[model samples]
Target: MVDDEDLIAERTPLPDAIGGRLREQLVFLAEVDKLKTVLRQSPLAAADRRENDAEHSWHLALMVSVLAEHSDEPIDVGRTVELVVLHDLVEIYAGDTPLYDDAGRESQQEREEAAADRLFGLLPADQAARFRGLWDEFESRGSPEARFAKAVDRVQPLLLNWLARGGTWRTPGVTADTVRARKAVIGEASTPLWTMVQELIGEGERRGWVSPGE
Candidate 1:
C-alpha cells in the first residue's frame, strides 16, 4: 500500500556523476541505497522503528571489527568485515526474511541467489566476481572469518532483543529452546560470546521478555 510519495526516487539521467566503470559503480551504490528502506524484524535499540538492512550490515561490520578478539580461531578481521558488508546487500532486492519465518525460509535461497546475480552484476565484471565470492564465503561459513562473522551476526539480534525488552523474542512461537537451538552456532565461533548469549536468554525468560521452554 505504498503511495507515490513512498516510492523510491525515479532513476533518471546520471546528471553530473560521470561515466564508464565509475558510473557502473555509482549505479550499484545507488541501487543498494534501497537497502536502507528494506526493514528487518528486529527493532532498533530505541524500539521506535525496525532497523533496515543497511543499518544491520553496518552494525555487523562494526561488531566484527570490535569483537574479533573473541573468535575461537584466529580470523582476518578485515576480510570478515568485508564479508559482513557484502552479506546482506542481496537483501536490497530479495528482502529481509525473518529468522523465524518458516514460509519465507522455503524460497529464501532461490530468491537470494537471483538477487545476488542481478545486484552484483551491476558492478564491473571483476568487482562483481569478487563481491559475489565474498558473499558466497559468508554464506558458506567455511572459513574462520566467515564463522566469526556469522557468530556476531547472530548475537546482534539477541542483544537488540534483550535491550528492547523482548524485541523479536516476544514474537509468537519464539521461545527459549528455539532461541538456544538457533543460536548454538555462536559457540562454534566464540565460546565466551555463546555463554553470554545464553545468559541473556536466561535473563530474558526470567523477566518474561522471552517465552519459557519450547
Candidate 2:
C-alpha cells in the first residue's frame, strides 16, 4: 500500500498561476470582503449606517494616525495599526457585540475566538500565528498598543454618539450614569481623551438629550 503522507502530498497539487500560500491569501481576502455588510454602533450615523467592518477597519487605520500622538507610552505604531485593523475582522463571523451588552459580550468572546482561528488560519503558519497573536493581544488590552487601541475604540463610539448623530443620547431610557460606566475605560487610558468625552456627555445631559443618573 502507498504511504499516507506521500499519497496525500501527491494528490494535493498546488495552484498553477501562483503558490498555494497566495491562493489561500486570495481566498481569505474574498471571505473578508463580506465585512462590508457587518455593521457596528447602529443608528449613530447621519449618513449611511455608522459603518460596516470594512469602513470600521479603515477608520481604525486612520485613528492610528490621528491618535498616535496621544499614546501614553511609546508603541510600535505600525504594529498598533495592524492590531486595530485586525481587531474587528473577527466580528465578520461573530457580529458586532456591544460593550454595554454584558450577555452578548460573553457570548461574543467565544465566537470571536473561533472566528480568529478560521480567519487567521488562511495565512501560512507563521503569518497566521503573528496576526492571531495581535488579535488576542488587542482583545486582552495588556500591552501599551492594546490599551491605546481600546481607548480609540471607545472614543470612536462616543464621538459617533454625540458628534456624528447630534447627541444620540436622546435615545430613550439611556442615563448619564450608564453612559459614564460604559466609558470609564477610556478615562483610565488617556485623561485628555476622557476629558473630551466627559464634556460631550455633560453637554448631552445639559441639553436634555439624555437623563441624569437614576
Candidate 3:
C-alpha cells in the first residue's frame, strides 16, 4: 500500500521541471489568491456585499488609468498603477482596518509592515524587494505616482459611500469632519477630484446619509 507521503506527493507533484524563477512566480501567484478572501470595510458599487482587497486593488489600478491626467504633479501612470495594485497586498495578512478606527490606526503601520515582510517575501528575492519597495512608496506618499495612487485609493471608498447613500459612513461616530480629515490628502493630488468628492459629501449630508460635524 502507498504511504501518506507518497499519497501527498502524488496529489501535488512538485514543479521541478520549471525554472526556479517561474516556480517561485507560480508559488507567489497561488499564495496571493488569499487576497480575494480578505474582506474590506467598503461595500461594492453594485452590490451590498463588502469588497475584498483584490477587488479594491483592481479598482484602484483602473482608477489610475482614467484619472492620472488629473494628478497635481505629472506622474508615471504605469508606476501609479503598479503602486496601487501592490499597496493593499499586505492587507491580505494584516486584514483591513477601518479608516475611522483610531486605535487601529495607531498600530496599523506596524501590523502592515510585518504583513508586507511575509507576503512579499513569498516572491523570489528580487521580485519581493521590488514589490516591498512599491508598498513602501505607496505608504510614504512622497512621489507623484505614490500621491496619485493614494488619492485614487481615498476616492474609491468615498465614491462607494456616495453610491451606497453613505454606506459605511452611516456607521456611528462617522461624521463629515472625520471624512474630510481622513481624505484631505486627496486635494493635494487633484483639487478637481477633491472638489467633486466634497460635493458628494455635501449631498450625503443633505440627504442625511452622512452625519453632521463631530
Candidate with best TM-score: 1
Question: What local lDDT score does residue 115 receive in model 3, on the 0 to 100 scale?
Answer: 86
Clash pairs, model 3 backbone: none
- Candidate 3 yields a Cα-based lDDT of 0.85
* Candidate number with greatest lDDT: 1
Assess each prediction's global lDDT (C-alpha) against the native.
0.88, 0.75, 0.85
Residues 1-214, model 3: lDDT tens digits: 2132422233565567875877667766766777899988898989869999899999999999998889889999889999998888788678889898888999999999998997777678999999999999999997999988899999999999888888889888889888888999999889889999888888888899989975
Alpha-carbon error at 84 in model 1, in Å? 0.7
**Pairs in steric clash, model 1:** none
Error of 2 at 193 (Å): 0.6
Quote model 1's TM-score: 0.92
TM-score, per-candidate, Cα-based:
0.92, 0.85, 0.92
Model 1 misplacement above 4 A: 1-10, 15-17
Our model 1 lands, by Cα RMSD against the true structure, at 3.7
Instruction: Give me the displacement of residue 95 in model 2, in angstroms.
Output: 0.8
> Residue 12 of model 3: what lDDT?
61
How do the candidates rank by lDDT, highest first?
Answer: 1, 3, 2
Q: Give per-residue CA lDDT, model 2, range 38-102, as digits (tens).
A: 97754445585566778777877888778887776787788888888889888877888865666
